[model samples]
Each structure stands twice: as C-alpha cells, then as structure tokens.
Target: MTALDVPGIRQVGADAFTWLSAHRDAFALGEDALTEDGHVDATWKPLGELAQTCASVCAVTTPADPLHAPAAALLDFAWLQTGRGELFPRLQRLEPFATYPLEVYSVFASAGLRHPGYEAAAATTARTRGWRSVEQDPTRRLGVLKAERRSGIRRPERAAPLLRRTWLGGLPEPWTFERSSGYALTHVVFHLTDWGRAPAGLPAGLAAYLTHWLPSWLDTCLDAGLWDLGCELVVVAASLPEPPDPALLRDVWPRIARAQLPSGALEQQAPQDGADTEPDFLRCYHSTLMAAFAAARTVTRLPGADGPGRPPAHDGRHRHRGPGEHSEHRERRERSGPSGPRGEGVPG
Candidate 1:
C-alpha cells in the first residue's frame, strides 16, 4: 500500500480524522447548545457539515479504518442527540429550513448507514420544502434533489417546464468559487453523482465545462494553499464522467499534507500567536475535517491496488468508488435537462 500510496493524501487524511475523533470536545456541538427553537448555534454549522461529509465518506470505506465507523457513529449519535433528526423532541422552535442538513442525510444514505435521519418524515418534509422553495436558486435546489435521490427518495427534479434543471444550471456569468460558493459548487458536483455513486450524475454540459476548466481552478486553489477547497475540487475531479488521471492531484496533495500540525490539526488560518494564546484545539476543525475527507475520497479514486478492496488499507483510502459508466450516465444526465445553458466556463 505504501508503495502505491501518494504521500500525504492517505497519511494526513488518517491523522486529521484521528485528531478529530480523539478531540471530540473541541469540535462537536454540545447537547445544550441548541436554542429554544431547536436551532444550534451558528458556530457549529460548518463543523457539523464537515462531520456529515466525513461520516458519509467514511461510511463506504473499509470497515477496519480507524476513522470509518467511529466517525459515522459519532455523527449519527450527534444527529439523533441534537434532535436534528427528530430522534428526540425539539426543545426550541425549529430552525428555518436550510439544505445543509439534507447534504448530511444524502451522505448518510450513500454510505448506507441506517438512521432515522435518512427516513424521518420531518427530515424529508424539511428537505422537500427546502427544494420547492428554492426553485429560483438551482444550485441549492439541485443539492436538495441530490440528497433526496441519494437518500433513496424519488424526485421529479423540475416542475412542469419539462427541461429539468441540472446542478450547474442557473448560475451567473462569473462563477462564484469563493470559499462558501466553492463548497456549494463543489458539493453540487459531488451530489450530481452522489459522491460518485452515479457517475451519470455528471451532466453533459457540466462535464464539458469540467473537462475544459477544472484543471485551472484546482491549480489555483492549490497554489493559494486553500487546502479545504482544493480537497473538494479533487473529489469533483475524481467523480468526473471519465476516470480522472492520477496526475490530477499529484501536486496539491503533498501541500495539504504539509499543513497538518504536529497535533494532527489542520490549520484553518495562518498561525496565530503561540501555543499559550491558542487552546489545545485551534479553530480550524471544519477545514481539517473536510481536508481529511477529501484526502480519503481522493485516495479511493487514485489508481492503485490500495483502492477500495485489493487489501484492507484500513485508512479509509482503500474504499472503492460506487458504480459509474461515463457514456451511459452522461447521457442520462443530459436527458434530465440540467446544465442549463451557461456560456462562461468554470468559475475562476
């Protein structure tokens, strides 16, 4: 496995997830943190999203991996405990519907973990409502649809228009690839295929867009050392209609690995004052979590026996990709009527 491995992509992924699992106190949302309305503090939102994505990515990977089951279970426990899944009573008023929770649910379904969140009527209702309300915003609506599909729910996708909206459709001329939008855009890509479960999830025009511009966007993020976003772009590349070249992530993986602290923490921002000023756990928990997940996902896609089941890599990197046949799936994605006529290429 080591011989076939690509340095930090695997090792750092394992270490970062380990740091998170061990240091649950610093990153996880507390039970009491929810407001009277059942809404968690905004502070935990990004961390929660990272946990959700990590749990999903961890779910399908090898069972023996240290981070796999534990991460998944922790997230499940947290979702149920937080009353986010309606496992318990909603102590406070409900937070207005956001598609973020659906992202977690979609990942959970893709990972095949059985949980009420996947089937809870409330959760489904929230997701369905979110999808309907976001008709004007295709990116968000597409994300919600992906969650529903990945959760094994059926969706008509578009209303009576007959031209169904793909995830990439309905964006402005200049791409919104900033941190928040980058995650949103990349996430939509992941959802397009449900994290590679359905390669056909990659629509024709979107695939064409990616084939032309992804390399530059990925390179820009890597050069900026935007480790978190870079990781997502890597996964986006991995989930392409065609098998991505092993060389795609070759340069950026090592740099992300290099950002890891001795404590297994992946720094979110530039180094702050000293250890004295900083707590044992720094503020970058979300980035670290996402970074690890990105690495694990990329490794599984990389060309090697270490992928998904040649042997128990046990590091989450050995997981296999879900089934995807480019030609057929792309056609289906095209037929769905998504990728709604964006002339400008990939966002800068």
Candidate 2:
C-alpha cells in the first residue's frame, strides 16, 4: 500500500474551501427563490449543499483545523441566507408537501441551528397523508428518512428496509455499477453514516463489501476524470469501518488535486471533446464542495489526526468482517496485496 499523503489531501481541501468561500455570493438564492416557479435546482440546492458540506466538516474537525473555521463560517452564512431560519417556514407554508425545505433545514438542525416555527410546521406536514405518501426513488427516500431523523421528527419507517430497496443495499455485482448508480451508492453511505461522522452506522455486511471493492470503483472514476463522483467515492472509502488503503488514496488524490483550477473550483465534468473552455460557478460548485467534504472526512481517519468531536478510533470492535470470515482471513487479505488492476467497462 502507498503511504498516505495527508498534506496533499489537506491542500486539496484547503484550496477547494477557499474558492467556495471566495465565491460564496454566487450561492445566494434569488428573489424568485420563494416563488412557486422558482427552480429548486438553482435556488435552493446549491445553498443546501453548501450547508451540508460545511456542517459535515465542522462535525468531524476541531475549530483549530484550518478547514473547520471556514466551514463553520460558511454554515453561519448559509443559515443567515435562510433569514436565520425564517424563510424555511415560509417556504414550507408555500409548498406544504415539498420535502426540500425539511431536507435542507435538517442540515442546519444537525449543526445546532434551530427554528421552532419551521420544525413545528414540518412536524405537522410530515404527519399528513400527502407528505407520508410522497413518492421518491429509494436513494431519495433514504435521504428523507435521514433528514427526518436529524430534524428530530418522528417517523415510522426504518432505514434498513429502505436500504434494502436501494441499488447499493442489494450489494449488486460490481460490474453493474454505473455513474448514476455510483452517485446513488455514495449518497446511501452518506445518509447511513451521517455524512461520515459515524461509520458504525454502516452495517457490517455493507462495510465489508465496500472494503473489498471501493478501490476498483475509485480507480475507474479517477481514470475517467469524473472528479465529482470521484470525490464522493473518496468520502465513502473514508467512511468505511476500516480506513481505506493509503496507497489507493495516495494514487488518486493527486489526480483529483490536479483537476482543481488555480482558483480552487473543480468542474463537475471536464470539458468534453478536449475543449479548453472554463466552466462557470454553476458547473464547479458541487464538485468543489464535495472535495472539501471528502478531505475533511478523510483527515479524521488518518493516524495521529485529531478533531474536536472525532469518533472513537476504529479498534477492531467496529471492524466489519463478512459472514464466517475470521481475523486470519482478513489478515491474509491485507497482506496479499494492493488493489488489483483497474476495473474495465466502467461507464462515465
């Protein structure tokens, strides 16, 4: 296994967050943000993503870490953008059945920001049949369940059944993995683990499966220049019960780091057909946010790293093993080698 390059990973995170902070205004919601016709994709999603990423960074890292303060500041800024949590209730009132308001607000709630009016309203809305029956993809349903948990709203559905419904939950054949499914798989892990703050939240079976295959998936993403998904995969690797092999991370992070523009933004997709055109903020925001998230999650897992509220270090108690698998089998696998050759036929 390659030696872990902690400094390199930190540098990638620092640059990405600095860029995000510098361009913070671009994440602001427009006048139409509260309107019926407002495009949630444009108006709310980016800001919500900012809050989520910032909150995750703050959750695992101490205020002393360079990444923590900016993330905290950004979280504050995002909360302020919601009119200090007032806008959420108004948005909820406007679209009572809409799930985005609760989903976005939950990130703030998890970060210690609260709005009584919004939570009260969401609680009532969640009890409605309309809200209860809202249809969503399995991955999205898991996200909503997680949001409800974070917001302290009561709901009857459990995550295990929902997990079984999603693509990753089934532990499907590795060859069947594709880009969209890859994102779905990563988000499932994020939701289950609370964005990497609690790796034990991941079931032993799932953790063992990922420990065996994540390297190949990560290599395929990096080889294809899928920076956004690649960063997400890195987060999944770090979130596993066992820390990822340092060699896998060391080999891929530099390629991801090189993809970042000097200004610190990372494009979701490199320009197609070899064009050199620069991507605007809309194209770069998510990948950059993810890069910061990936970095913050990873540093906490590295040996000798410290964070304010870092979870107890893995001590074998939480180490996941496949059914009937023993310590000797795991030891042999660890000693057997680095990851095998890259997976073939992986779609971008």
On lDDT, the leading prediction is 2
Candidate 1 off by > 4 Å: 1-5, 31-34, 37-47, 64-70, 76-80, 83-120, 123-131, 134-136, 150-155, 159-167, 170-181, 271-282, 306-348
Candidate 1 per-residue lDDT, tens place, 1-348, comes to 321456667677778767776776554556544544434433345445655655556543665554465555556444443444442223212443545555554544454443453356534565455546654455556566656666566765552132134334444233334455555667677656766545676668767767555655565555555655666777787678775655555556677777677666775544434242322454666667767777666656655524342222323122332211224333433343323222222221
Give the lowest summed-lDDT range of ten residues in model 1. 309-318
TM-score of 1: 0.69
What is the lDDT, from 0 to 100, of the residue 231 in candidate 2? 90
lDDT by residue for model 2 (10-88), tens: 8889999889999999999889999999998887899999999988888888766888878877877888889888899
TM-scores of the candidates are 0.69, 0.87
Error of 2 at 247 (Å): 0.9
